[model samples]
Target: MDAEQAHGPGGPRWWRGRGTPWRSTLLLTVFVFVGSAFAARMQQGERAELDLFARVLLLVACALLLWRRRYPVAVVFGTAVAVALYLGAGYPYGPVFLTVAVACFSAVVAGHRRAAWTALGLLCAVHLLVAYWLYRWLPPSGDAPASLGQELVVAGWVVAIVALAELARSRREQWARERAERAQAARRRADEERLRIARELHDVLAHSLSVINVQAGVGLALLDADPEQARTALTTIKSASKEALGEVRQVLDSLRTPGDAPRTPAPGLDRLPELVEQAARAGLTVEVAGEPPRLSPGTDLAAFRIVQEALTNVVRHSGSRHARVRIDEERGTLRLRIDDDGPATGADAGGGGNGLAGMRERAAALGGTIEAGPRADGGFRVLAVLPVKATAEGGEDQ
Candidate 1:
């Protein structure tokens, strides 16, 4: 590889700061040189006497490791060549092999397995030639040929080192994959949470504000003509505003203490009376048909919101002054349908805003579906079908 590619980002932890292995390589060089000097003294009259040339060869082999983290393939072969020359010159065999092993291990872990193996094979071939045949010509006069058993033992050691490097590489890759998966999961949860909060705020404000808007208009038009009726409209406004603030505060509390139980139970079909009362204040008469079935918490909350958004749409967008809410259950499913009796004025006819979209999302999140449009008769309707048992599979058509 080129120098730029070799020294690129994400090389390895060892090459993290300063992007060099200078200190470690310098220490290894000193250790190998000093250790070899001790081995030369121990060999005494058996091997060639330690000389300036032999020391230089040892330094070259260890120094090549300085680039092992960057140019692993080049460093592996470079160290092998230096060590082969030292052995071919009949220098005493000591800590010199450590340099080649370190270089080979680095090359293998850096995904240059073929280069590391080729360098190792060449070094072994050179050692065989020098020990058995070239000894008569090159080495310190009368050196004997190496035994077959000793060669086998050295070959096994090299194989074990390569295997260990392969294992380490596998583990590093596995850890990287796990970390990526965890990060992706975290982001998915955050997006889901943000969408949920947006839905809650939309439902609470839309319904209450629509009621307050109608009452405020009534109070303005009748302020002087009928003071008692205007006073009643102002009172209705106060009640709607207070209820809206309470629901908003409840939603915010859940955000502040994420895992804790809500201070008040979530609104459900059980609160249908209160919802109807709120709609009455907006001048919409609602009739309830069919009983609400017991459902999972997620299904219950979604059912309530669908009803609320549908009624709010009627108040703000439908010209109808009357609406109908029908609830029923069959085959472990809860079904809700809200209908208004005339032509739509704005968003209820699918013109704009997230009211209809939020209702669809709430149903889909609980493994349900929402259908909304103008009826063949003379009005707009919203129909939602939710599984009584909660699930996160989004939804499927009924």
Candidate 2:
């Protein structure tokens, strides 16, 4: 069988192919010989010898178990019939019935529920018929005839064997279901990790490339008229490139070995001044207000990214050169707002692109909300509110 089928629910183990049949056959042979000898010794008046015909029947029944895994129902019925015939011919009760019971158990464990139950019913019915024959035809001297208690004891044994088989089947199925669920959970975790990495790369590269593009244009414009201005622009380009490379390497290192300490602490709201300075070099003036509040690592990183992306948008899309940033925390909510006095420029003015989506995902993941749009007063605005602590239901802390 293929690997998938072999490892699937109720699937046989690999070694079962080479081991189970021979082991079962050997066990049945030992049971048949030892039990028959024990039964003969248990005889009261005269110990009856196992005739050649009865011995042959017992051997046949034991040999039939070699095919039990392949033909469980057939083996059960064949062995039961052989044992019944041997008993009818006045042969002692031995382990011939054991082969039948083992076959029935194997059938159930192999996922043959209907066949196994049918074999069990047929075996019980044959046993009842044999009991009646022995009670009517065979006279008892001093001992009592076959009683209902004896029949019940035999039926109880059959029921116990079937119950054990059913228990094993249920346990196997439960384990299979659990294994499948664990596999699915692992796949889901892998997919989520891939999406997280993709979003990180998009955010880092997009912001860095936008800054580099602006600096290169500035350098090219001033290369002949003002060499010093061009040199300053080249310096900004170099700085942006170095920052991008460091952040990219950090991301790659995280992917290589998760849980390792980062080479540098992640930037948070404390780094807003650096972001504003970078924007100033790109010819945009930024005004700031309110102090950064204490935040969870995730919320802090998300707040930084939101402000970074908003400033990058101001530089790349807004015509106005001045922007305002506001940070406020009150009653367990940390609020951030960035606005620029520039006319709306297409969808970029109203939140479009992976940057905005990434911002939204981050805020929402922390039980927070973000809103971006063109303000009625002729400027673009982005606002976000994050909870101090995330709730179990992923809602804002109350």
Candidate 3:
């Protein structure tokens, strides 16, 4: 398993790296002393009492548990073998089996299923053999052999330990999977936020820069011929620049504090008149046909951007001074059309520049469609049809 999956969230670095913690060492020390003392005490008033060798073996089995996480299978096998040897040597039963049982549990929790089962089988077989040895060698009384009850109890205890370990392992794996999924979701949200910011920045800067470029050129050309006209052009540039700066700052502020109320509402269909007046100042005479209908916020913003981009293209690329805009709702669709009397050129054509692509993206996002091309009568035209409500094929209403 990978480190992230093995350790899960909030796991310590030492545990994640498969290194033993100081607590394990402390536990090993405590178990060693306790098990050795227990084995020595079980030999009270017995002719075959535990000797120094039996105590040392029990201590060694307990100490082996400190490395269980790093070498689960080996530790389990080694501890089991030590316990078997101590028992075979006729040592009295003691807490040494406690260390072996813990080793079995660690093996399963560490994902060593085969080793755990093998250790369990070995332990059961050793218990049966020890029971038979006690029956044959120890003096038996009228009471049914006590070894039988002890063996049954130890078997049940081993099964319970294995079951609990498996349960814990399953829960840890599930928690890891959930953590990974949440991390992926957070990344997706961050990417979507970045895309939204890019679209807003492009729309604001592209339209404002195009207008300033046109007005600056006009002012330069009329500088000597008509000084008054040149001053008027300069004044228009200043006004447009200031307005663009304020809008740009507002957009940035919205991003900086998304939870705060916006400084100004987003521009929508209601702001078309101001957009038309600005285009007129840029020397384009735009004629309007139909009144805009009430629209949802998303649809309103998309409609306004489509109109602004279309008019900006007309002023920059279409050499015509006159343009027509028509807005009408028919059959649950809002149809927007803009036509100019300028010849279509390669630089202003749709599908080849950011402006038209941005407009198309806006339209498509709103479950709408856009078409822009040269008209048969020697000018350019852009037509867009947006749904009043989101379409089934377009996902949500926004």
Candidate 1 runs further than 4 Å off: 1-49, 63-78, 107-137, 142-146, 347-352, 392-398
- Top-scoring candidate (lDDT): 1
lDDT of 3 by residue, 203-277 (tens): 776677777777888899999999999998899889888888987887777667558988889888898888888
Ranking by lDDT: 1, 2, 3
Task: State in Å the error of residue 356, model 1.
Answer: 1.9
How many steric clashes between backbone atoms does each model show? 0, 0, 0
Lowest lDDT block of 10, candidate 2: 2-11
lDDT at 83 for candidate 1? 90
TM-score of 3: 0.76
Judge candidate 3 at residue 11 and give its lDDT: 37
Kindly report the root-mean-square deviation of model 1 from the true structure over all alpha carbons.
4.3
Measured on C-alpha atoms, candidate 2 has an lDDT of: 0.76
Q: Rank the candidates by TM-score, best first.
A: 1, 2, 3
TM-score, cand. 1 vs. native: 0.83
